[model samples]
Target chain A: MNTLRRSVSLIALVAVAACSKKQPPAPAPAPAPAPAPRVNQDSIDRANAAKAAAAAEAERQRLAAATAAEASRLDAARTAARAKLGMVIYFDYDKDEIREDQRVTLDAKVPILNANPDVKMRIAGHTDDRGSDEYNLALGQRRAAAVRRYMAARGVADGRFEVVSFGEQRPASPGESEDAWAKNRRAEFEITGGGTALKVP
Target chain B: MIKSARLLCVCCVCGLLSGLTPAQTRAQDTAVASGVRIGLTYDRHGKPGIAITPVSGPNADSVRAILIRDFDFSDRITVIAPDSGEPPTGALNYPLYAKLLATTVVQAVVTPAGALHVAVHDVAQKRVALVLDIALPTPAYSGDWRAVVHAAADSIEWIVTGQKGIAGTRVMYARNSGRSTQLWTVDSDGANARPVAGTENAMSPDWHPSGKKIVYDLLPDDGRHRIVVRDLTGATPTWSTGAASLNFSPVFTPDGSKVVFAAGNDATDLYEASPGSADPPRRLTSRKGSSNSSPTFSPDGRRIAFTSGLLGHPEVYITDADGSSSELLTASGFGDRLFRSNPAWSPDNRLVAFQSRINDVFQVMTISVRDNSTRQWTSDGANEDPSWAPDGRHLVFVSTRTGTKELWVLDLDTSRARQLTHGGRVQNPAWSPRLELSRQP
Candidate 1:
């Protein structure tokens, strides 16, 4: 009986020891800075690279803005030059000949010719849709010629100006009213050659 | 004496050669120049009274005079003076008569209806080769006389060229007015223009094989676009497409039985509609995420070439009429940087002509189907929207190089282009098919 009690006591002691759940000893503390060295270097390099990219992007945007500003300025200058060189001479209805009222416009256009002596211009004369195309074209030419003659009288060389007839080919605005016809019957100046290049070829 | 007489004979022969009468040779030249012979209308006195009134007014006299003086001008009939009760005797005698002096007689008259009537008579045939009438409102001043006379001359041009005159035809174009883009049609000479439809953002315009119907895209109040066919023959159009969605670039099959137009929102594809029916459109292209538009039918209706925006940007594509076996025709990768659009099939169906933006100017260019070679036809202006003349030897396009867009005709063979419309900005020309039956030869 004594032997049996001793063996059971020993088995119980072994089970208690297994159930105690003793933990393994913690690993020796690592050397102070080894764990995170590569991560820190990686983060620092990434931060530096991002800062450089941001600076480059900002610089690019500044350059783009400058380019855009320059383009806008050039466009404005061209528009101004075009306005100065252009002339719209009005005519009477069904007739492409210059009317007395249009002489004032012609007088104003003389300064442009004096300023741009070498500028070759095309005077496209137009008419309302009141007649056949061929008739309108011939009428338009006469109107352009009338402008040309006036320009010549104003001291512009004849060779600097060419005449084209758009007779009923384009309209300022579309309508059958007298207002439209009056607008359509006019000569417009187009700068064909020798003007400062507004946009490059 | 014999040697002197021989020398005199030689001198006489040389003198005869030198003294060939200038007036007599001029008469012979005139006879040769006027290439027609005419039988005159017999009168009671046997004198043909052909009266020519002065239609030349304003600046036309100078232009007409220039044309006549510079160009070869001939007459088929010689006018003789009238007898005493009328001015001269022997005016009716044929002994003094000569052969015809002109090929065609150009008659100019201001008709009773206030229209200018110009008739070209082939004197030998004694029949009118061409007659052109131009309607001009009575002038505020004396008369629109110069325009009328010039118009008459232009009408006679049809007789000389053997092509239908552009005087009576119309031009269709797109314009922006008061913040709205609309499709409009005007007289070929740029008169009587009004909005057909699409008062807001209209794009391509396809005329039915029948000149009566014009189909174009009309933007809806909701912002989506739909194709609408308007019959311009009536004062008000009859809308054929009852439903509205994102429909665009509609073209009729060669037979005009069905229309193939682009439909849908993101997945745009071609659809054909049967006449007078609201049947659901059958989808043609099957590729998902692919958008196809601007479908133009071949002359035989066997194939259609369209622009596809499937892979990034737009490219020209051709497919069978039933929408199968698709292939890409234009490869833009190699130095060809032009932006090509508006493919118009040639009248012969062997070539496709299109407008391309090159060096900031749009010009008409054509590609041959057999060799896939392309050639540019125009370079003078901001030319675009080329429509082939029915004869296939000419193309009419729009140009803005004059600082305004206008219709211009380019002769294919001559490589010469002339402006057609002057005062109005015209574009999107769809040339009519040759009339099935022209006025008999």
Candidate 2:
């Protein structure tokens, strides 16, 4: 048992010594020169510099894209607001009251008015030439007022809408038949805010 | 009678100016006043040179009284009862009697036939600074003596003023009765309305630039619309072209060489055709996948505006007559809430008025061409088919807010609107250009 133990210890010492040997003996050939430490340091420095440049380029591209997107967003909003400026609400022939079916249109207008707090509209009422001039004029006034009232109730400020009575003077359709008279009676809205955005439907 | 009429004609012309210096106005008013004296006398025929008595016939006094009353209202003339005489029996030497009247205060003589031979006297020019010979229309004393006198007085006013008198002018328009429309001609102030075309779907009338012809679209029983032009002086109407799919809303070019209209092939498009030919219509607008209709020309003929549906919705678009460089003028879904059509340009090309659909209702809207400011010219009723008056101050259109569609007029400056037609539904109005009369020189 003591001889075996001594032999194992000897093998371990031999393995460690063999692995630790740095240079191979070749009949005492010229020993190899040591490499310069600064060469490795220079390589490491170039790698770090390239990485920093890449990160800067990426940041510039991201900023340019953001600016372009912001401009596009502003243009779209402006177009939508201008389009909604002259939206009009129509009515039945000789009738000044708003119909139930027209609620959807009125609802659509609410957003436009709300978004554009400074926008003002002129609500004009028109009638066909079926009645006396004085009567049609009065009816036209009522129709315009009805639209103004509805808009005011729907969160649009009362001061935003002005009423004008064209009476029977201006007919969308100049005729003496039911078809034309039906087309003639109605109310229209003109935007008084943000310049003239009069759109014809 | 012939001699008496000539004397009345001269007096009518001179009498209109005589009242300018009413003894009261001349003495008291703070403006320039001038007066003309008119004398009535009968010419003597086949006599021993004896002056004919002016009050010979029973109708003579009545006619003279009518003339006197009319002359009193004139701005420049006054009726003065001078030496009166019996009416002559037969043919009188008119030139000789007119010469004799020159020696007295008389300026001219009137014949019973209602012809006025105004004397070109040398002394009158030196005296009143007015010397001109005017032949006036003979007034018929039998039916309405007042009418005759008024007619003579109007003639006098015309001689004094270089402006053509409105006494003989006529106004033409379209009238809607029940479901059909008819062409109508009337006096300026809604008097003597007579249907030129018996119950026909006559829409969009235009006066020939010459004012002698009217072009309109007529719909026959076949439901096809055709363009027809009628001679206002006579009865017969001649169709310039055969039936088309829908040849409605016709208007004459400013020069009267061509007619621009909207016709339906699958959709309505603008077309131009010559006045007296069957040439195939020259299409002005292409089928841009939308219904393009209601073409109107500007006064200068450089620009045109029509309703087009190119942007997925019907809207008013302005372009050159040849359809180049077209631009959308109105916003989509406007007047389209119900239905919108008919675009008319003001005479000055400064404004364009159109029908728009709002909330399922049609209304009238106008856009100023200068700054593109849009305003609702009408509200309340189903107003459509707007045509501008020649003066550009008033507009005529169709409306139906009062239970029936009728013709209406709106004065732009005053914003005053009035109903023109009482009954039936009227649509598609085109104001005629000014009319010119061929004077019997």
Candidate 3:
């Protein structure tokens, strides 16, 4: 008995909610006003036209609200996606090839970037303090380009991406240790365009 | 062209170079009377001993000390101190200096008339070989008087050897100030270091052909590196590479006409641009799947030497100024790691110096531009960023020999190196061309 009552009440509440969305509150038509005696043809037509216009206006409002809600939702998704897209990928010493261990990092960015076609990006490459600063810059660019190519292959527009190299100029860590060096040889991502609204992958 | 015949104690050479020589060899440095045989060094017999006599005045003691250090840096002359009272002003006791094995003596005085009175005495000839009255930069000890003393020492070197000393020139290097790497200038002797204005995030600095100007890679906010030049006389003009490109390692031609640099879209390639111009840069070198950078020009400006990773690792390469007739300069893939970069062509056009990876560490190496013969220079600690002094016999490079990144000047002739900076991670030293200031007061 309790289950049947709960179902009935739930259905009624849904019906009311749908009504409020479709049209603003108004008294139900009074039994067609007892078939108004000798109503003029022009008056009848005008009344129908006003009712139809009201329905159209209510439909437009519902759609505008739905669109706004959808846009904000996409904006939030893109914000989260941009953060994921910024995740860095590492490379081996003196090597620009994407390492096996770094695939997951790049994989995460690929889907985010693909889903946000309007978003442009700058992929910067960096190196440790071991090699020449100038050549390390080239090496850094190679690493950044490697990341860019990987994304392009995965459907991120190639022209939407730019690569810059910091060489050994910008070290993520300072020292000569293997750990410091490993942390420094990386390609990092930054979003350059496409504001809030983003489609989630 | 001065030929100074000095005998190196066979016993000393035996201990240092594993070769014995008697004092009789007179290991002569008979420099052809053309100019300075700037390539001479102490690794051989060295030069005749010299003495610094007493100078009278308030700053005399400090002046003498500075001059001693300057001459020592030559690596061509051995300095000595006089035992007794100053040589009688009338006649320098040539016998006293000769007996002390100091065949040469130097005398100077901070005269009351406000000049550094310098006299280089040749004990062998029983006469003074050189004399100069240098104008004093007043307030001596508190001012830039050190340069005045260095100039006097250089004059003595000129009289003793054909090569004038580099003491008066300045070095432009970048010092990492924890927050940013800023450009700085110091004497080649490592004194009077000061940061340059507007050089906050700069690196790989090179001097314009005229010592009055400098060019360096400036790191801006958008992550793109820009090529910028500043004049010591107060003009800062930028050589725009592009708004969306990576511009690395910009250096000026010896003639200061075009700025040679490395910039690229997909792969880094060498390029040349006009200073202070916004026009597109002319591409110099390109490869299908490789990166080229660190473009340095030979002294004559006829050839360009740079580093490329076309062979799967960075190696030195040489090409004509127009990027034709390219040939590999240094080929090495030690431990399967092809790490070689920072190619610096020698001022004499005889060698191209670069850093090579060996045993998992970086060391300075120079390859013969004429022949493919290579020589490893610094083996102590990780040494990189080699820049040749105007003399070509001296190279200023960054080294971790002291357990930190410090500036070091290596005298190729003597095979001896000295630290120029202490305490900070200094880098990218560019030895200025011999300027007129070194010859002035």
Candidate 4:
């Protein structure tokens, strides 16, 4: 009986050793859960920091592009204003009618005048030095009236425009050539009021 | 009328002198306060020859030169130089003057006290026609000497032709002096030229019938063209078309009571305004869509001649004083239908002179009111803005014949044109009436 009891005790000790090795697998699951929570928290903090930095960088780039676009738009508006102000409409000899080619120049003025409602403009008619001064004065007045009528038809108010006739007294180019006379027979526009707001390029 | 009276007085003087002895006649001529009178008749067959002896004293050469030039410019007389051996000073040499085929002889001498003595001899009448003595303020005043000579020449012209010469008168014109165009007045002989208007853009000056006022278009610095009636007696603006757009081509009525001008912004029309009226001007024309301008009244102030574009182009039109019964004076057959402007009525009440465009060039033309017959006086270079002299036998106009616009005077009888102003484009000549009131010694 004593020898049988001693052999059982040795078997029990072997089982105990095998159980201890199995116990390690169960604790490993518990510690694995704690370490997993810690690793997940650390990873979450790094991901959140990276996401905020990326969003800030994208916002900065967007603001830079928008500012560049606005500057370009203002520059273009100023250039167009300058061109519109300098535009002149030519007329035929001894005629006050507006030609088809001159419509384009007149059309460009409509938008500018409409955009600035408070602006007052002067439409001056000029003629070449060919006819009598008194007669030329009448012709120039007709030309200026024609221009005013055209602009009025295109929604420009009459109150904003003042028509004047320079007749043969003022010549754009002082000469007797056809080219110079053609230049002299023209309608010129001047912004008499509300011109301070126009940005110069 | 003054000439006929002077002629009668001269005949009486001749009758009285013929009854006296030669020595007694000389003593009576020196004692008579009236000038010596001799019956002088002009040769009708051709231009009469007048001999002028060489003058002596201070500024005598200049005076003689001026007299010769003025006589030549008269276009009514021919000057005959004395023979090489002829005496510079002498008594009546009627036979010798007749031998030279001269109807009249002029002798001038200056005394040591700076007094000018002029004598006119009638070759046919065999006597001195007239004698004039002028005292000079200073012997060194050459201008005064010229003036005295001009006055004598005028007197001689009146005695010969029954019409006063324009040598003592002045012509006002618009002179473009580089920076600005101003109104200037020059002696009829183109001497003593000076600006009458201030330094501003002025044009189309017209003289008052009284010769004491001027009406012109003044372009002020404010850019508004105004018709200003300026008084020469005071050198102040009597009236102005304030803020009127396109007011121009103003002329005083023949009676000098009203001013007719072209005024409008869209359709120009003639309007009459008083010199000092505060009321708005009276519209003289009612034509719509047609421009009427350059108004001039008849000598009687019963009719007005103006330029109108009613027929698609400018043409001269005449209307009653109230702008009624309009008649087209210029026909298509007279000139191109492009332009006719600057109408000036003659004092004789027979002709209306204007500038008409012919073949793209402007020329001076006249249309008789009775016959409607048109006659062109200028064909070379653009001639325009005709103004009749007081005598109605001559006209002052602007011409571009010398490649620059200048003032010129045309004699109707001789059809001769003489340049009056040189340099710097000039235009719009206005001949004044007899300026006896304004003549300065």
Candidate 5:
């Protein structure tokens, strides 16, 4: 609005001048625009410097965040692989013989064992509360031995495994239900040595 | 034909069963508690009816109550009711007890000198058969004197029947605590139940022949269980297997010379060593693929009866003490499956008591060693781990008949079971041999 007002006033002044001269007036050349207020060269350079610094800082933070997330993901994957190496395999009632369905679980451990020959494992057998603790101790040993035997047959070295039986003492679940009993009759694996760095199979 | 059932009602009220809690057994003498009929174990037709006469003096009521309960629990010598009225003030009217169908009468009087003056009178002979001056520990209702009273009762049974009773014995078992089973000892009558000192993780305790020590398997967290021998007196250092990977189901040779236990990390097998020495134990069972455990020495210590998981399921087997000539004792089938374990050879060496699975429930049964005749003693619930009283006619076992696992004593002749423990989930009862703290009549 100000610019337009200035322009209108300037045109009026020109027309008045032409009328006072008492000569035929045509559209005169528009007057030259006034000069902008002067700013120093150093000030312009300072503004450019601040903008560039802000952009660099934002880019650096994005790179750090991405790096942290990648490290965390790798850590979680290693932990999961180590836990899988110590997985539990369950059994049928009063049976030490491994079921066909559970073979996949044992099969999963073989490659992990093979990948890390230095690793030593402890395989413990357990039972439901159905039988005598003494008898269950024997039964648990059989189940654990059965597991160890399977691992050995699959090329796991005999020296790399330790077998034990907890009988019905250490149950995976509590109470007297079919589900609890089924969960209790199992062979559990634990890494005895060389477990710090697990190679996922 | 005695009214055994009617008296049994009073006996139950009196907590006549062996392992009922003390609070249950202490509710004694409801007027009819005086006359529980006892049946002699050896004789079938001659029950040998006996009357426990009323006594006089300090703790007379306590003395008479314990005496009568011991005889009633003897499962020998029929206990008849005393005469309705007292005999003439000075003397006992033997004729009255005889008229009550009592073949023998036990007259006890707590004398002024802290002695239970007892006389065993044969009613037919009309003469005093034997006299016992048993020292009566004052304040009999509590403390260890009850054991003395029980011993006095055993003496009476001994003199009258010519065979001693196991009234003075105690039962050892493991009671489940927080995460572990603790060692426990209770009187044979289910009185004086207390945990053995510092045996919180012990399982399956067996009594030493001398009754001065116990052997059990210590359950540690590392899966390296060891057989531990602890002296009850605590005067001697404890003995244990320092190297075995899994040692359990420990028992002492009947002669107290050696300890027999099972060790397995490779395969379950029996092992033996000097009970108090640190010598390496020699392996007893050689079967590699099978689990051979629960070793029980026969009476003469020449043979062992154990549970073997050789053929898919556990079965009872007898082998020489040298671990040779293993023979299957329980081979016949209930229905194509044989699940028998927890073998306890009788003290008389004639019967082997074990648990057999029937309909998925284990029941205590006895197999005659001589003839292979099997008799099932428990039916209502899962009953296993049968340990015999030294008398060979009674047994202590783990039974779930009452809904919780408990220790129960079974009279083989009467097929009667007495609950020995009501604590939380008890198992593996080992009845101690007769603690002969008193003179044999």
Candidate 6:
């Protein structure tokens, strides 16, 4: 019974000492700067360097793809802007009044014009090879003026539009038929300024 | 000798017995020079017979042929073949030509030193009526030959009719060939055609009174039409209105000191500009609700005839030089309102010619200023842009009778029309004034 008591007391003391070694005083705080093993630290440093290099290469590829995409987008936008500006609105024979069907064309221009305040356009009026040249000039002027007035009414400033008339002088079609004449009597829009920076969404 | 004496006696007796008036005396003198007797005179339909002898030199045949063709085109004389039996040199045998009833005999000879001697013999007068000696540097070329022969024909015409011929003058017009329109000038007989203006798509060319300059409208690829005054003497643009809202149908005033044209943005009206002047253009017409254009000054330079839509339809209107006293000139002639444009005042100041639309087809017509009697001059195809010749008896206009637009000249006396230009769409033929002697080539 004595031997058993001694052994139990010794085991308890060893257990207490192990606990104390594992759990030191709370005030002791000097372990953050301790150096790791040299061999293991070298391997860890090489791994981190490789990972960082991979990440940089990935970032460069991403930038190149983004730049190409941006260029393609800008090219497509320029083409679309040119097409929009090239849209022509036809008119009837010996008439300067814009028809109802042509309003849709004019309406499409309003947004583009409003979005680009720096854009300036020339509204040119052309007539079929009918009537006197002088009379045709006046008719073309009236047609161009009608277009300009419509745009001005639709929030476009008057200063942005330059109206001109080419009476029976410039024909869209060379034929003398009614269909050709109809195509010839038209109002065309030409972007005279700020075309280089045009963006179409 | 006896025949000559008898001829002189007969002429004196005829002069005394006829007791002719001044006009009649002039006609008789022309008939005597032509070798036609007074009683056996040719009627208006019958032209005086002329004989052009074969000239002996290089390219003489071509020169003679040109002379024959020109005389035939004159519409006042007939060319007869040379008699088979005739003297080759010296004085002509008037009796032989008299037997053939030839009125005038022309003898042309080319000297060795590139000179041409032309003699006109009057069979009835039994003497030489006129003589001309011209020096030609290049007699072998057709152009030089034609010029010399034209000069000789002009002299003959003057001696016979007391009026100069139009062979030496030129007519400027616009020609479009499915691609572009260019201004060109052709001789009255339609030879030596060449472009005058460098700008393409040119139209409505009007010659200055001096015949040294031309004013026209140029439509560039940029779709801007402007008035351009080109100097033919220097082959350069003396003045141009540049790019305007609308500038067209420019015409020189009678004095040629200013050019009146149509200019506007919304509504075109008449405006005058003095070429080479720093002053801006002066506005002439300002009628509201009316687009006035086609301004043509009168021969007196005091009045202007233009086309106005003030009456709901295009019609001819006359105004003072200051654009006041506007009067409607074509309203009373047409029963109903018709589209009348391209008003060109007659050089004689007696009539105004314009194109009137009837049944949707345009025809050239003229209305008398004094009596208001309208006469239709063209009925075939669509005819527009009538311009009067300097003589006031001929008109040059655009006609589509041959299925294409071409220039045609109409004679007021015979009511006949002759096509001038071949190939290409030609229009707005403005006949230049009588060219000075120095201007003829």
Residues B115-173 of candidate 1: C-alpha lDDT, one tens digit per residue: 55455455556665555554533341111222233234333433444333333234565
Q: Relative to the true structure, how large is the alpha-carbon lDDT of every model?
A: 0.55, 0.56, 0.74, 0.73, 0.76, 0.73
Fraction of native Cα-Cα interface contacts (under 8 Å, chains A and B) also present in model 6: 0.53
Q: On residues A165-192, what C-alpha lDDT tens digit does candidate 3 reach at each position?
A: 8778778888778999999999988888
**TM-score for each candidate, following the candidate numbering:** 0.47, 0.46, 0.78, 0.78, 0.81, 0.82
Query: Residue B427 deviation, candidate 3, in Å?
Result: 2.0
Evaluation by lDDT, superior candidate among 2 and 3: 3
Q: In model 4, what are the clashing residue pairs, if there are any?
A: none
For model 1, how does the per-residue alpha-carbon lDDT over A1-201 read when each residue is reduced to its tens digit? 675566557667756865787678557456445324545676788899999999999999999999999888877866666775685878886554568877877776566557666679878777885443223444565577778877787798877876655556456667767898888898888887877764321
- With a 3 Å backbone cut-off (N, CA, C), the pairs that clash in candidate 5 are B19-B419, B19-B420, B19-B421, B38-B78, B38-B79, B40-B77
**Candidate 3 stretches greater than 4 Å from native:** A1-79, A196-201, B1-46, B83-90, B139-144, B177-179, B277-279, B332-336, B438-441
Candidate 6, residues B284-362: lDDT per residue as tens digits?
Answer: 8888756788888889999999998887668899999988899998876565536899998998899999999876768
Q: Which residue pairs clash within candidate 6?
A: B34-B103
DockQ of 4: 0.23
Q: What CAPRI class is candidate 5?
A: acceptable
Sorted by lDDT, highest first, which candidate order results? 5, 3, 6, 4, 2, 1
Deviation of model 5 at A152, angstroms: 3.3
Chain B structural similarity (TM-score) per candidate: 0.64, 0.62, 0.85, 0.84, 0.87, 0.84
TM-score-wise, the better of 1 and 4 is 4
In model 2, the Cα lDDT at residue B54 comes to: 43
For candidate 2, the iRMS in Å is 14.8
lDDT of 4 by residue, A1-201 (tens): 675566557667756765766344544343324334555676788798888888888888888778878877877886687469658899998888997899999888888777778778777788987787667777887787788889899998877877777777778887778999999998888888887676543
Error of 2 at B201 (Å): 3.9
- Give the alpha carbon lDDT tens digit for every residue of B1-441 in model 3: 111223111100000000111121011111111112222122225576667887787566667666766777777777775434653577777887776666678888888877787777889898877667766655553214655566667767767776767876778889875436888876676655666767888888998876767788887656778877777645355444564378878899999988888888657788888876768888888677788988899988999999888888788888899888888888653455568888899998899989888887789889887767888989998899899988789999999888988889998977988878766789888888776542222
The deviation in Å at residue B114 for candidate 3 is 3.4
- True-structure RMSD for candidate 2: 26.2
